[model samples]
Target: MAEIYRVAVHYGNDNGFVEYNLETKTIKVDLAHDEKRREAEEYLAKEHTIAVAQDGIRDFKDQKVNAAQDVESFKLALTRMWEAIDLHVDWSRPA
Candidate 1:
């Protein structure tokens, strides 16, 4: 059977948010807007800035952002990254 992989984001204190990589399954903290969470992915893709990240994270963040056109394609890529992490991060989980 296939796996359950998706990008899941939950609210935190003071507008803070936690993002799951769904690919490497790793999570990163973005203090910026919702888009920033996805844009930061450029670091994963090795892009120069968030502009090109849209082409990568388009479907994930917005239909626009980087110079690329297709957005949904990017979102599609996040599925794997989103599944790698634990998703829920409250530091309250049993250790």
Candidate 2:
């Protein structure tokens, strides 16, 4: 038997819920309350993408600015940027 975890998430003017099955490693989204579910989904997806991109950009900028005169620090900063990119890609994948 698999364990299922349920979570309710609210954003903007829309309300939605998500269910995760641990054993199968799958997630299901339920947007039952919203009349415009498709539009709301699209809007939320776009907002999430934009937010992730902004965070990555901000992190990269901060890392570069703080790395000033240290070669090792700059290399570490680059590594952080690459890691952020990988994370963003993973996060944006469709369920």
Candidate 3:
């Protein structure tokens, strides 16, 4: 059996859950029983995204910024810092 990745997006009175079958590259969505839940879930999802972005920013600030002697060295250091930040984040969504 192939592994499945499940993502649940909650709304006010209901929820919409999505399942991705990695092996088959198939997607399935299970929506909430009522419309209210959808709204709540959407709001919560937005909030979660914001929080994740904030956390990512914080993590990025903690990375070491190397002192470079010239423009080329500075660019290299900046690239390395960004790469480090990327590795530090376990991105559930874009952050």
Q: Regarding TM-score, does 2 or 3 come out ahead?
A: 3
Descending-TM-score candidate ranking: 3, 2, 1
- Over 21-92, each residue of candidate 2 has an lDDT whose tens digit, in order, gives 566544444765554444433332231211122355455232222222233332232233323322111122
Which ranges in model 2 have alpha carbons more than 4 Å from their true place? 33-95
Q: For every model in order, what is the number of clashing pairs?
A: 12, 0, 11
Q: In model 1, what is the error at residue 30, expressed in angstroms?
A: 3.2
* Worst 10 contiguous positions by lDDT, candidate 2: 44-53
Q: Which wins on TM-score, candidate 1 or candidate 2?
A: 2
- Estimated TM-score for each candidate: 0.24, 0.32, 0.33
Model-by-model lDDT, in order?
A: 0.36, 0.37, 0.36
Error of 2 at 79 (Å): 23
